[model samples]
Target chain A: MHTLREIEERARAAADKPAPYGSDLDLAAYIDEAPERSYVDSLEQLEELGEEELARAGVVKSGRQRSGSFVQIDGSVVHRKALEKGLEILSTREALEKYDWLWGYYWKAVAVDSDKYTAAVEMGPYEGYFMRALPGSRTIYPLQACLYIREPRFVQRVHNIIIAEEGSELHIITGCASEHRIQAGLHLGVSEFYVKKGARITFTMVHNWAEGMDVRPRSGIVVEEGGLFMSNYVVMEPVRSLQLYPTARLVGEGATARFHAILVAQPGSEMDVGSRVILSAPRCSAEIVSRAITKGGYIAARGHIRGEVGGVRAHLECRGLILDERGVIHAVPELEGRAEDVDMSHEAAVGKIAQEEVEYLMARGLSEEEAVSTIVRGFLNVKIEGLPPLLEREMRRMMELSEEKAL
Target chain B: MDTMRLGLGGGDLEEAREDKETVLRVEDLHVEVEGRRILHGVNLEIKCGETHVLFGPNGSGKTTLLMAVMGFPRYRVTRGRIFLGEEDITGLPPHERARRGIGIMFQRPPTVRGVSLAQIVALCSRDGVDVEGLAADLNLGDFLSRDVNHGFSGGEIKRSELLQLLAQDPRVVLLDEPESGVDMENLQLVGRAIRKLLQKDLRRRRTRCGLIITHTGYILDYVEADVGHVLCDGAIVCSGNPREQLEGIRRYGFEECARCTR
Candidate 1:
């Protein structure tokens, strides 16, 4: 583990390095602008935003009152809540002293440079959540977190960490959103997760942004032997541009990692999203499934799975639907096998809805618009079994609302 | 006097004598699909509470006539107008025609991905007809949640079509080859469903109207056909008693009917 001084120095040194891929966006212009203070008039604004965006992200605010849940606003921790025992929820600055052993995973970034965003965040990093589930702890209820933006032309950079110790299980639901009418803003987030031996962690992230916003999220996960890591990511709202490619690596025998993502690119938006998984140990397995819809926008849906050891199995599936003539959907699926006994497979397809299928629905008393909405809803409905009932219901409701807006 | 006419050897005069009101009327209908004319100057009419069966050989424009009447965008009508119960629907879209009480069971409906059969059926129902109950009646209870016509067997596909028809309950039902690919077991169920859909109940006289297109004449065994018209080369060449016409065509074939009409 590197010292805090070394971490700061590395971030400054690596700040000028260009992104390895997906750098079609303009980060210099955003870096030149000064960050603004969040202009939230009242809690009602945050509550309204919660209903408009966070609800789709599966975080239902209890009336206008902030419940006993962790909530952050404009890169600052506003409300903090967690279980009393076997769990610790704190900000990165607060956690620096109490959990010295955690610096190895939290302070030392992997696979992503601190300078990925021009060192704007690493030089004077903003506050983000740190959740740790002690060994043998198990909870049915998921920890809820929200990161909200209320000001225009502001930059909210967050670095979050989740560590599930040996034999523990934890699920976290995080929602990120901003005011729908905000002028322009940027959100750069980095998240790292550690699932120890025999531990399990399921992370669900929902993102809803305004049309002038640009988002870049970098995340990675490491699963120890006999551990499991599952992730569900959904983005339904429109934004100027979004680029994310989260990776999960199974480094121990019999570990498993699964990723399911659903994205919608509205008019004038560009999205380059994907999930990558690497099975590095024998008997390890991984599955990546993604469904993308482009309505008058552009989307590059990407997926990659690698089986690097014998007796490993991995598969990737990516499907896209283009609903408008002006829309463009691209699928990029890659698979690599390094051992003779490894099994890897991938499938990808992109197309528009068929005319006959639309006519068939029209024959059944549905108007053309109604028929299209029904078909798009069904196309976006990729079943993820074993999801908690409440989360599943809210997720489905969000998809329905998204489909209604698309039509 | 009947043999003096050009097409169908004289069904117009007989149609004028009927007391029932005409439910559907096609006059000088010429339809083209994909720049190729498939129907030419076809004239046909069916009254309320009447069932008309059209018989012809393969590629004889039987399916094209039904599709044209349904107002499919691809099946362009170059001439003539279609009337349903005093209203002209020649230029209306398929869904508009459906709203005005026109329903069709296609010979081979294409499979729809992700849309369930029950979902489409629910859309067609205005009276809140028990979808699951109707599926049970047509032996499609197990396929209620499956994608429409996806991976369905021949019999199951037929049954699914009938299930949709039952839910729709339209005033004018157009069936294209109801028994062409169905087996005996499913045929009975499909026929029963069609009979019920047309209100052919023993307790009450049949009131719903239908225009059926068949090549095998096997459906005649299950439903009462008031008339049989042999359509050859996109024109009705002969019309007579349903059973008598079937027997003659069975022995002499459509070639004889075309020759006799000429």
Candidate 2:
């Protein structure tokens, strides 16, 4: 494995090239000014940017402000409580020495030199969370982390890692957003996850940004034998543009992964979100589902499932609802099976709300707007079993709040 | 046994009202759907304590009249006036009409995805309406959690429609072909439900008014309709006692009624 210094040098070397992934998004206009420095001194001062407002953006009441939490604002770590039992929360740089084998070993799984954004995060000066759950431990409460943007024309880049040891379970909830004020910014996020044998991890991420902001997030996960990984992503606020394609690879027998997302694109926003799953071992299974709504913007939802070994199963579904004539929604689904005994399938649908449905609700005493809003709320309801009750209730409440905002 | 004893409500209609006050009136109504005229120069009036039955063959514009009265947007009233108890609701939207106590039971309602039958019933039901109890009453207990009218059998769909009508508790009920496409078992259940909905068991005074459209005339056996009108080719050709007119049509066919009108 390469040393930390050598890994940093490789990241610096890769910063010269641009990533060749999705559609080209021009970042020159937003990054013209020098990035703003963190000026927040206390948690109270950070709250002035409005913690309640930030919480509402992600449908959270208030973040876990209690003990054992990590809060960062504008590339600065504001407050990080002491470690809890069986849990370790460290900064990426500090983790370099703590886990010697993790330095240059994981970067090989993710392409750092492919683009400028990844390279920016890859180089030395990034701030993110490095969390690990000790073996044979179970934690029901989620370890909360937050990242907030307060200045205009600023570029924020981050890299995060999370690992669950064998026979352990953990949940991590992350909230990322910009200040409510009208400010343009760019955010590049890279996350990697590892689930050891017989371990489980649930990750929930919520993003809220201004219409002038651009976001590019790349994530990857690998699950060992008898392990499980579940991910939920949501973005309800308006952003200039966003592009993310996260993947999960089941590398051991009896491993499973499920991915779900909800995206709402308002006026002047463009979003491309997708999930890919690779079943590489026998008796492994994967599922990906997404629900997207576009009011007057552009949204493209994609899902792909690939089965490389026999006796593997996968399912993918993508559904989109367009509210305005100017709005556009595209559904792209692909299923590939290489082995004869593998089972893979996918489904995609894109359409406007039925007029008859609106009328039917209206005839039952609901106004036209209420009828439409109710249907949109129902359309966004995608059921994912095994969620913790509290988290599920919070998600539902946020969906209701989003319904009001949608109308 | 009282046939009009709705599971959701129990009131003697005989003591509720007295006299023939006009509850709904349509004058020279002209309606077009998809640029094709379906109802032309049609007039109808139902009193506060009366139930009117409309009899017609296929494509006779009976359903169009009911839709026009309920203020459906697609059924454009090119020239007409609709009055609900002296209120000119000609330009009202469907919800406003519903708020004014006008409700309709569609022959075939479109299935709504993700909205459960129980959820919708709860949305429109009054405070006293027992949604689960009503579901049991309609034999729809197993369907309460399912999507509205989705994957339901013909009988189940009709029963579901009646279940919603029962929840709305409207003053003026408009039923379109309630007896059609229903099997024997469901036909009895649907007929009884419609009788209760129209408040037909309260002896001399039928307090709640209704306008029922039926092609089979099977619903006539369960509900006591005071007046019957025969419609043919977009016009009401004759009017008389419902049973006698039904008998006349059944024995002599609609041509004889047309000849009598001429």
Q: How much does candidate 2 score in TM-score?
A: 0.90
Worst 10 residues of 1 chain A by lDDT: A32-41
Candidate 1 lDDT, tens digit per residue, A99-191?
Answer: 777777864434435345635466655678888889999776677788877667777877788899999987787778888888788887778
All DockQ scores: 0.60, 0.62
CAPRI category for model 1? medium
Candidate 1 DockQ vs. native: 0.60
Write candidate 1's Cα lDDT for B176-208 as tens digits: 999977889888888898888888774765557
In order, what lDDT does every prediction score?
A: 0.79, 0.79
Best by DockQ: 2
Residue pair clashes in candidate 2: A18-A115, A19-A115
Q: Model 2 Cα displacement at A215 (Å)? A: 0.3
Model 1 stretches with alpha carbons more than 4 Å out: A1-6, A24-28, A31-57, A63-68, A83-87, A107-109, A118-120, B1-17
Give a tens-digit lDDT track for model 2, residues A1-407: 34556667777886666554455655565442344444443344554446576565442334342224566666766655434688887766678778886664456545676577777777535677778888987765777677777668767777888888898887777778887674678787888888889999888788878888888887888888989999888888788888988888899898999999999999888988998888999999998999989988889888888899999988998999998888988888999888999988888889999999999888888999889877887787777776777667656765665556655
